[model samples]
Target: MTSAIDIAALDPASRDAGAVAHYGDPVREQRLLEEKVGLVDRSHRTVIAVPGADRLTWLHSLTTQHLEKLQPGQGTELLILSPHGHIEHHAMVTEDGTTTWLDLEPGSQLLGHLERMRFFSQVEPADVTADWALLSLVGPGTDEALAALGVDRLDPPDALDVPGAKFAQGTQPPRPSTIYRVAAFGAGWVRRVENGADLLVPRADKDTIDVEKVGLWAYEAHRVAAKRPRHGFETDHRTLPAEAGFTAPAVHLEKGCYRGQETVARVHHLGRPPRKLVLLHLDGITTDELPVPGTPVTANDRTVGFVGTAVRHHELGQVALALVKNNVKDDTQLRVGESTAQMDS
Candidate 1:
């Protein structure tokens, strides 16, 4: 799902340019992402478009969210699960009257699953990543930045019957991009996540917009601090939404049947997930290199879990997200590789 355009190259100060690791000043960038504003390149993500009259209802029946009443410009997240309740796919969804748009991490197989379940439905899911590039603006300066781009404010109107509203074609009045607390994108779509706004712009027009750029390190540090779990980083093949605090925003417990509703309901009413996610504060003095994901997390010399996303925060020196045995005591001392780790309070 990566774009041909190297978005990291957009930052003149970027180090580890291939992965957009940092802009030579990770702490400053992290501060910008937290207090001011920082733009992040996410063109490596994927986009999917599902068009047809039955798009919303079709998605509602197949995923973990209640999307049948979804309005145009409104945004929500959904998870596709295995019949046994394991999370298989996750996407941020929004409808634009004529089509349902899905924003997913790279390598998501949600599109193929949607197509296979189209037994006579009017929906047709197609990969549209080639036509779009994703970018994000984080921190308190988002509104000001959007205003500078001629997007006065984010107030998406109700879904109208415009045929090409998404891309603004055929003389249709330019439709506002989807907004959930934030709005962006002039020729594509936008969605807000926590304290940031993600903009998807046409590939040809992406470079036209001007903004201060940051690297992936800044974003990851903030995400780890916020306790937000990501798809690939926080999940494994046997992951359940409840294990990562994904049940509230990503699942609708009482709506209707989905691929994995049975397992979700059983876990909710009968028992707790075997593992639970926690934030860990690492003892930086114990190691020079930060622990990477998949590093074994041990309690009393016994492996208890594995690390997910680990980062050096601008404020909290070193932090990480990990999945540990639910039975582990809250006060237990833990170790991440050679460093002493404590549950972040």
Candidate 2:
């Protein structure tokens, strides 16, 4: 809606729904993110407010990450799961001393699940999607970009208080949650969601920031090349956290009881996920057609898995992120449509 229109205003030829599509030459735009700074639109995401006397404790009793001791402006991510341990929802979590904000993907029933789980904890779930918008700066000079806004030496991952800026709608920090740094472009996720730092602002102030805007294509290509697992693209109802490689920062192995802790532990100790996510080196020179998201991946002429994303990286050429059988070797040769794919390290 607003995000689509905003990107359209910036790049008239860009194709997008909520996330960025691209202006032109996605590869150049992707390189811009690495070499300099590029602004990204992230307004399509969902933000939920959970506030109550027992909200923190109740939330800690659930999800994978530890949130019981969250301080003001401290942020961490968490995953809500089925009792059986199937991946359900991944949320970007943060707090501002009052309401705990859970930023998540659109169409997630996490709020409904919370309502159902709210027996008497005094927790309330409110959709605040209309109240805020997310814009991210991708590149090495993150502090420089923030300095341009008169905000300097930002202690990222936490939140920043911007003075005299239109992005802040209230007294809350500019980032309601974690400012996930792009690990692919520079460091690791720690690793942040989709490899970028996120900033939240009132939708009314979306146009106030002064930053170089890059297309969605740059962001998507970087994600695929770096082998990041997106919400709907790499994971689903049947997905496991380990299957998508969300073990360390997203899930703590020693945390107390939660919905899927047992299964998560069981898989880590003895069992392995049926499939594992891997980076695929697509044969770009030989094959004209690249694998789409759901193109079956095969090894030894048998269906092992399917393609998640096939992005033509400027440096890596045509590459993809694929989910394949755990047994498939890292160097195994695979096939996706007419493209010959290989499981790369």
Candidate 3:
């Protein structure tokens, strides 16, 4: 789908206004968010389609979510891990009876892994990202804005039924759309508007709204505050899901078998993850001299772990998400660059 606005057109303004925040300068988009409830262009995310008689059974055997029980219109966060139990991709899995859809962040390599797995199974996998357009409506007044859009149902469809226009999910007629509720900042929600690429309509109702285009800066701050981890940053192929906080709702301990299950189960039962992801609030630090990703975290001259993401909070000062040794106490002082950081409660 063609974008209505070009990044180049807004580049100068974003730079001059210092609004190009978030990982990709989501400021212009954030502005639309503040003025009127904004529709975020999320077409960059990739979608993979799994279809066949064994679609549900096949995906159930692969992902971390309980795919076997998913009804239509229902979707849940899934983690695809490596054989060693390291995170490969974090996805939103939705089932529509005849088929299952895996929506993931771009560069997750989910399609490649799916294709590789097809050689061992009867499930048919295809890249369907081109067939859909995704959008996220965030900021304050999102619920009212959604209600104005004729979406009254607050609950998503069951995991196995075909997903359509509903609370978090909306699909243009004839084509299927699935929406997943993801963590966001103050009064924020993500909506995946699939199909109807031509019907690019922004929400028109405006009441009690303070929409601001959230740039990477704002998003980073919010994500850190929420203690939510990203794909490549807080997690990676070398990091176990348990270590990255995927053992909760994202990982299914009761689900039978899947890649990395043994390690995940072992860690869960032991209740001792090798590393822990912690929120760090650093004092005497500035954004211009923030610690780089993967910088080793040291406590008492002993290497503990590394930094994942760092951002200067508007109120909290310089903060970061660090992968640290599980043994570190909340008051433990860690050396990161020239600054010392303490784990925030």
Query: How far in Å is the alpha carbon of 110 misplaced in model 2?
Result: 1.6
lDDT of 2 at 201: 72
| TM-scores for candidates 1 onward, in order | 0.85, 0.82, 0.72
Which parts of model 2 are misplaced by more than 4 Å? 1-16, 155-196, 285-289
Better of 1 and 3 by lDDT: 1
Please write out the lDDT profile of model 1 over residues 1-345, one tens digit for every residue: 123334256644333244466657778889988888888877667889899998988888898877887777677788899999998888877666777889888756777787889999998899998897778888888778777877756643233231221232343222222125334357566666567677878977765667777878888898899998988787888889888767766776656788889888777665567889899989988687888678999998999988988888988888999988888877889999989999863
Please, what is the whole-model Cα lDDT of each candidate in the order they appear? 0.76, 0.70, 0.60
Better of 1 and 3 by TM-score: 1
**Worst-scoring 10-residue span by lDDT in model 3:** 193-202
State which candidate, 2 or 3, has the greater TM-score. 2
Candidate closest to the true structure, highest lDDT: 1
User: Against the true structure, whose TM-score is highest?
Assistant: 1
* Candidate 3 segments exceeding 4 Å error: 1-39, 120-122, 156-212, 284-287
